[model samples]
Target: MMSRVAGLFRPKEAPVVEQEILSEKTAADKEANVISHSQNDNSSPSADKSPDTKWETEEILSDVQAGIQDVEALAKVWTRWSLIVAYITIWFIYFVDAMQQGMSTTLTPYVTSAFKSHSLTAATSIFSNLIGGLFKLPLAKVLDIWGRPQGFTAMMVCLTIGLAMMAACNNVETYAAGQVFYWVGYNGISYTISVFIADTSALKNRALMLAFAASPYIITVWISGPLADAFYHGPGFRWGFGSFAIITPAICTPLLALFYFNYRKARQMGLIPERKSDRTFLQSLKHYVIEFDAVGLLLITGGLALFLLPFSLYAQQPLGWKSPMLIAFFVVGGLLIMAFAGYEKFVAPKTFIPYELLMDRTVLGACVLAGVLFVSFYIWDSYFSSFLQVVNGLDITKSSYIMNIYSLGSCFWSIIVGVLIRTTGRFKWLALYFGVPVTILGVGLMAHFRQPDVNIGYIVMCQIFIAVAGGTLVICEQMAVMAATTHQYIAVVLAIESMFSNVGGAIGSTVAAAIWNGVFPKKLADHLPVELQGNVTSIVASLETQLSYPLGSATRVAIQKAYGDAQRIMIIASTVIQVLSIISVVAWRDIKVKDFKQVKGLVV
Candidate 1:
């Protein structure tokens, strides 16, 4: 076995005719030539060789081929069982994610009440968004360098720590810190899973696998809200978060073990190349510093955080847009962002994002589409449940049920689109031609029908339509981006795509906050009777009190109308954003999903 393994790397010998020619030379010359040829052969093997060497080479090649065939057979068997395990793990992750989202949505009012601050919910959301965006690039680099198992382990550790912190928190600040950690972990894990799925599945099955992985969200959407509501009303909201902290690691252990096992097998089989570094400790530190591009991460994260900070702050601040701090944040953040662009373009030895990806029409279009669609969705969604409670007068459970129709539609259509893509091996035009128009129509209807007197059925229909469009776009855009790039860059590119989407959500939520804060209070004061004007601040601060006014009373009607007007503006903004998304879809090239070929390349 040892001899056969060594033989695989042994050089072939010269042909018989070449040996005869060498025999014709002077004995001393032939000896010198043989020495020179052996030296050359050590550096570069020759294809032309002697009969004995040829036989030896063939035997070694045959042995290596047989080994490869055996490894392939073992790999197939492992992949079949492991993929099932992986899918199960992904489903649990999605379920937990959905539960978190549901709890966050339903428990916002309670959390804010606990903090005795109206702005706490929005503040936490902005902070979470920042964390999610900030950590994605670093996580991408970690996955690239350390491989998936380590990356996944790191993410799980962060998540567990974050959840524990949240469960133990007594103050809003601590809770906010917990959220930061949780979101960072969540974003890392989510992005890693996407790349993992891409790595494990074939191109033909990737869409279906991703869609199937997401199916848990659909089920969780219905159950999580009620579960959270039960927690809120029974054992308390802390338990809602605490239970998951313990449950997540338990569910994730097997998945992590599977990843470790597969990695070990692959490494042993020589399928994975070993990374060699001979630098000193300090030198190694510097090498990694440049490799991870830490400065680029700081600049972009700081820039984005600063730029987006003011948008959320302006509405909450006493001075509003006139605040000096807001202006400074905006200006400095803008400059840092520009500096980051310049650094990437000319200064960085290795760029954090490859310029080639930016130039790819499909990738660019997918990012824009995802960004714009998120902006559109969030514009209306940021304050949607509040509207349902205040204006529509629905209870927490009912409003949650109504809101989750969107998730239901999203999950259902995502699966359908995935199957269609798998069957037809096409997605770009489906998103462009069908998804864009449907999304436009949904947002348009939402804008037109957001009045207080609008039928609940119409609202539900609009949610379903928008959700379906969102689902279609999500699957298609992901497929387009993945298909356009080689596997090496997939994780980072996906991170970049996620960054755009999260940034869009932050901006949209901020904009919605600005619009709502700017318009709602003034509208409420204007519409309310003179006697009730003094209480506008208190009323707007607490949505519960806003809904406490007697049904069918003049005050109730005025408050409802005010909410309707504000929501209409938000819906219109969403409509405009969706229209922009539709226009951007024109840039997407119709890359065939089936034709995607994984190329060998270094991670940038």
Candidate 2:
């Protein structure tokens, strides 16, 4: 196994055009020139650039760099063994994190079921996913300019608070808040780590490294299920959520220790620069406001929530689609989104997205691909575990393991794709020729097997089939975004990719909620196989009620059939949208990793 894994990550030179072969010195010179040009562009902006603005921007940059940027530079003096240890350290960090995530995933559906609002699961998910996605925009600037320590600190705090909130919550509103808080915090940490990987690794090694970093999923899937099962059945999910509040912060110690060690080393070597605050309170405020594009973030978040929430929720309105409340949501959301676009394109000093990257074909294509992939997944995935337990009569442990087949399979398969990528130094053809075909087959299979009376084994087969392509598409799209720019914009690039992915999840959640609520209730009346029916509203309201009857009993069978009917439509919709991802893949520039260092070479 080790030998095979070694072969997969053994990096090789990519084919290069003769004239494009850059000498080592020339490459260094080009990098230096690019840095210089960027510095000059900022230092000497248009005449409209204010004195206060210039001072605050540079001062903030210096302060942030002085605090943490030296840690990366300190690597120049590190031993090879130390670097290996650092890699192992982060891997362990993710291991602990995966345990927390596993516990949370297992508990989520029950939290809603406890409230008898299991069907409203996707409704809460819309906000959680929306906030999680929108939060990345500001975080990119924060991590990019403000450094990792602060980001990590914020992440730890949010996580601790969020977990505690979920643990002690008295009602669904608080549970929903817990869900939102937890997702936001998780997204922040994920963005930080991805940017760190991008910052430290070579482009050719990126997909391989990402897949390896994600390898904990293989083990975690097996363990997380039992841990969650033990907790849920033993002390209940409240205790499970509460345990992580303390455990996660404790697990984070080693990662922070590494940062501190690097910091002290840099300080000892005189690598740390001394700087002081030059901007006054207001000036500092304005500088950060513009840098983070706080206004734009607000507009987009409000816009997306207002606009998209209506689609999912319109069925709840008295008049359905014609409800005035729904109409207002649509209008307000559309206007805010439009206003956000205008702000970014014309009014804002620094656009919410970095202007140059926003224009890059690879970046744009990555955004679309990421968005579509997530949309397709979340549309049906929001209730999959619920489906397993309620429909198939699988235990939580069994259901959790079944769900993670996608993650476990993706982890291994992505490594192979990474190998192919590392060898050939290109990914477009892999995405087009392999990822697209498998996704179509998998999703098509899903639409077929996700019906009443179909064998449970066939559904598992569909997951494996989808997992075959899932890993490849995920790696390819992310690498496409990363390949477009230098480390300077790595965090922002990741933010862009994640933003799209999260937004897509939000869109998917909305659509899923619409289907589950709108279709399942309506179908309950028509799809019963027998006359042995119960309270329609009661069954629709809670999965617990749906499962109250014996497995083969009429109400239970009818509810399962109704879920099957709803899920079929959801999966078919997912299948239809997934084809759009092929267009995004085809639109990507097929740049080899060897040529990636040429700035703005995204067009190929």
Candidate 3:
């Protein structure tokens, strides 16, 4: 009692927080124990006959569980002041990174136009998104094996390299190349920070923590437009990109140093154990090659590239879909995808995929939900900025405000949704009945208001509506997936789950391109008078030509009609696919974050 009284007088770590972390570790161990027992009882005949089978998933899982335990144990050593400093640094990093994103995204069109390759926007988006998604799986393994600090460093390297490439690019191809590295880096950094937050926060409180991490969006939405405008007017887009290449690294260096220092301290204190392998150097290289499932990733990447790229390019080619090259791409891509599935299931000794988690209803459902939502959103959204500027006669600054208001709504409301989840400890009804419906309503509204001569206020309301739903879905679905898995595989789960969004976005972009290139030119010719029909090629190629004719003039009016006619087809398609989110939510087994026993694929 006297010692307790002294403890009360002294500055102490929050006991509730400490207790929660300790409890989470215990729960993770218990979940693993149950899985181990199940595997032991229901052993395969091949495994029972040969106990040395390398395919035993339990070994990999046990190692991951051990790492999580070590991380939890290490957290106890973090001084209260250090944790505060680290979190504040994280917040600051996100703030600056967000501003950088806002600057670059707002400037992308102008940069492309500067190179006279504005028409290649879809190709660039599809390629970068694919690179970003493909890297996450390998990067997840890197973080799981080496440490978060190392992963953060790799992320910074990619970011800097890509930014520098973009800043110095002399052609569209070089800019696209830079986009590959920068996108992967941007995604890697975002994922690493979130995983770091997950490493420290308790499961019950993680939603709120993650939601707060995204709070920079709320502020950046307002600032990014004006800032991008300033750079456009003052320094030009290249200088804007060039300055961030220098600035991002300078700001990120301090945080990177802090991460390494803490990681080293953890190692020296015996909180993290060094990995040991008996294989020789060459053998170890082979082991990692297998561990990373490099072959599987290559197959999938090849397949997706061959399969998906055709969607965007087929329309641009002379022969359209009938071209031999396009046919071969479709056939080879399909074959490669099929080969990937077979290899993962029957060939890879150690797959990166958490097959067990994928089997879980909640995980599969949430992933499908996210993928489908992106498919719908990107279909309409991929060309929206162009539409606003070309058809509605809006400037870049004003268009940014209208477009990014979604960010403001989603960011602000995510905090509210996070609080709701934490308070109630359930997400199914909120996700299914509320979030899905609101999202559909928003998408449906877009289908109506996106036409020519529609009031802009109606479109803004759609943004507000979708923004709130987006905030709701972001927190709700993430919680649903988290509650389904144990601590060990959270990073893997998140990375793979996010890959679905990328896949969906890629598909959406491809389809949007197909519609724009396939139908828009013909529609433009139809809308224009016979005398003006000769200008179709020029109008399609140049945003300036499209917008040069003042609003209400025959040319501008015809352009608006063509824009509405094409985008309406895209909007209707988006709305149709959104209903899939409901089905994804339905597939989730109701699990509560507050329930420790039900945390790992256990239904309440």
Candidate 4:
């Protein structure tokens, strides 16, 4: 029994008559093994047993290596082509986005008039700004998990639906809801494009690629205002919203399809591992919920909304700052934020805002600088178009055009700065050397020359200076943040950067509203003669009412003067904020841009 068991475990051998043949075969097999193993020493031992085995193993190995090489080659081809397509698609999307934003800006007065409320304008602006910023957190996660094509598709769909809702809405509340959806989608798309660009381009060429992708903003900046004016005057505000609903989807479909094709091809070629979630539906859902950190998202969104809404609501509240609702919002919002901090620090499995990034001085400084810069910008920007039309006696088209000089400057200088950074691989010095003084000079000049009688030339030049400063700082700050962080943190850091900027914009809009609403009406009443005093309410209600008076009439002049005084206060405040922004620059550390290589082959 023992002998039989041992025999069962032993290998079978050929008979003695076949030994010579087997030796001949073994010799041939050995030769083949040597040739195959010379190319790849990692071959399995079973491959050397016979000629047939050797040929089969060698053939399998060659096929696999070739397949891997083919996959790698195909990945390169897809990456190269997809990058070019993505850039072009992003440029077009940006142009449309600019046009949409311009339409919103120009149509604000009309939307308010139709709704018969000026406060609604401020409220919608604040809501959209806040919501857009908050959405970035979840959107970032979505891009990481579901991939860019899905995220892009979601944004495009949201935008289209939002536009449709706006066009068909009959009430201010509905209109406001539509704006919320549209802005969230718009901001998400912008963020996604930025991340895509970062993923595709090398660190050395990133800034230039970003600038090139953003180049459409320059053309749209100059043309959007005029286009918006025509649409509003001819086809009406509904068309302004509805037209994009039709056009944007048409443009996005092909691009999305291209992305899907590339992504599928990559997976098929084994360039990317297959995403496997071998769980029940409910389990998968739970897994995603935890992965996305849904609790953290809700906490932050609730906190920011409650905290920021009061700024717009305070003016509408009869008791102003004394309102119980305002007090509750602040108190509750503060508690939620504290809770969020606690959760992220201890309870949450995954933190949305990485604590490690906060510890990095350069990243933190860039975020702070962005926040401050936007705060300064929006303090004046929130009410600038209305100010130009109502106070400075400029037409809607001309005012929009003039306001976009800032954008024009931003677009032009971004490209120039991008080229310079690519060449020098130096961004910190550029940010400090040029960004600070130019911004201060621009804001200071604006404060001094904000009067109705100031030359248009001087106003444009001041705007250009401020815009160029903004463009330069934006690029440099982005570069600084990228250099300071590792690949895994880049998307989150960028999201944080955008979040701070948008939050600052919301705060600035609120502050501007508080100042404008609190002081402008009172000042207009005081400046107007007794006969025109009753028109203060009307003048404040609509820019048209303010502009209806004869060009040089006393009523018009009073409105202009009142607006000028109020605007001066805002501009001066912005100048102070800009100075603070410059001071924030000191915290940034000089990191070599080229020494770091951004990780390649990220799908998003």
Q: How does each model score on lDDT?
A: 0.71, 0.76, 0.75, 0.72
lDDT of 1 by residue, 182-254 (tens): 8777777878888877655555557776787778777877787788779888988888888988887787787
Angstrom error of the Cα, residue 546, model 2: value is: 1.3
Which candidate has the highest TM-score of all?
3
Shift of residue 41 alpha carbon in model 4, Å: 31
**Each prediction's TM-score versus the true structure:** 0.83, 0.87, 0.88, 0.85
Span of ten consecutive residues with least summed lDDT in model 3: 34-43
Window of ten residues with lowest summed lDDT in model 1: 14-23
In candidate 1, clashing pairs total: 5
Candidate number that wins on lDDT, 2 or 4: 2
| Runs with alpha carbons beyond 4 Å of true place in candidate 2 | 1-72, 528-534, 595-604
| lDDT, residue 472, candidate 4 | 91
Q: Model 4, 298: alpha-carbon shift in Å?
A: 1.9
The whole-model C-alpha lDDT of candidate 4 against the native structure comes to 0.72
Query: What would the per-residue lDDT of candidate 4 be over residues 1-604, giving only the tens digit for each residue?
Result: 2332222111222100000011243576444221111112122224225322322322111222222222222333343335456566777888888888777777876777676666456667677777778678777777766666777888888888889988888877788888878988888888877877765555656788778767777888767778878887798889989999998888777678777687677566445554466899999988777877888878877887788778767766789899999999999989888988898888998887776776678888888888888888888887788877775667778998889888788878988998788778778888898987898899888887887777777888899899999899998888877777654456677888888888888878777877787778888888899988777777787766766798788988888888888888988888888866766678888765554444323121
Q: Quick one: ranking by TM-score, best first? A: 3, 2, 4, 1
Q: List, residue by residue over 259-312, the lDDT tens digit for candidate 2.
A: 677667756755566556899999999988988888998898999999988877
What is the C-alpha local distance difference test score of candidate 1? 0.71
Determine the backbone clash count of candidate 4: 0
lDDT at position 470, candidate 1: 83
